[model samples]
Target: MANHRAAWTDERAEQVIGELLRVGVILSVVVILIGAVFYFLHHPAARANYRTFHSEPDDLRSIARIAAGAVKLRPREFIQFGLLLLLFTPVARVAFSVFAFAAERDRTYVIVTLIVLGILISSIVGHI
Candidate 1:
């Protein structure tokens, strides 16, 4: 583990985190764009009405169903998955912060980041 710790120098961790954010955002945009293109292709003249409000479909509410749909190349699911990825990107960064702090041997920051991570997770899963 000495070698692993050595590899996670502060600069290295920052660079990786920066790259991770960049890649995550770009991938999310690309996925959302692809999903949009497919959606428009399938529904050239589709329109939404502001006169009514509707909740998300039951099938699309859960992660398992979303993954299943996205895997099947469903356009809406792709869009949803992209949005999910976008939302998860920050959560992931916070999670990595715990490791980054631990690698730097900063116990206080590690604990703080863990608390933040826990809060993020609870907020995400709390409504369920």
Candidate 2:
């Protein structure tokens, strides 16, 4: 009887692990698709620029020089940068929720994620 119980428990554990793996794969694919859409919509040029900027030490120096040339309008650019940073808050929240749900199957995480997104949207509308 004890042996039979142990075998049943092991089988249940395996089944749970398998289900988690399947969920994880599906969640990963969804996250990737969302990221692709966001990237294409908001900052299609950002990846190319980032690659060039980090390509070498000479590239870094060149980027620095270009930034230095923009010193006169730095204040305006800084404000724009802050707004751009704020725009990412909702995307980050969604990504975090996806991972949390996939790893732990927690419903509270979904609620928290929605709250974060609401706050981000409110802040953006209020501030800008």
Candidate 3:
């Protein structure tokens, strides 16, 4: 009975993780679409200038600033933030896995997941 319960718990954790990823993707897409709607509505006359590209301002480059801009209803910034969310989904999954492993008392996986998470965080932060 104890062994069956353990297996069931592990299965449940995997299911939850899968669901989390699916929901994250869907939410990110919805946010991106909302941003797109705002962007087009606000700038009906503006056309894309992909041939002559210019980088976004420094303020919009950072996550903190992007979030602030989104809160202020800046469509472009909100789009960027949505992209940021898409990028962060995997990281969130890893973080969640670390906690799940810890809960399961799987020391090796917990340590390994933590290492992956640290590396992931450093890579993102290093650019900033």
Model 3: lowest-lDDT 10 consecutive positions:
1-10
Q: Put down candidate 2 lDDT per residue, 26-111, tens digits, no spaces.
A: 55555445545654665556544554444433322233432342243343233333333344543554655545553454568667
TM-score of 3: 0.86
Q: Assess candidate 1 and give its lDDT.
A: 0.86
Stretches of candidate 2 exceeding 4 Å from the true structure: 1-8, 47-128
Per-residue lDDT of candidate 3, residues 1-128 (tens digit): 66843553567788988998998888889989999999999999997678876887876888888998999989999888888888998999899888788778899999999999999999878455
Candidate 1 global Cα RMSD: 2.3
TM-score against native, each model: 0.86, 0.32, 0.86
Residue 1 miss distance in model 1 (angstroms): 12
Off by over 4 Å in 1: 1-4, 126-128
Clashing pairs in 2: none
Number of residue pairs clashing in candidate 2, backbone atoms closer than 3 angstroms, sequence gap of 3 or more or interchain: 0
Q: Residue 108 error for model 3, in Å? A: 1.0
> What are the clashing pairs of model 1?
none
116: Cα error in model 3, Å: 0.6
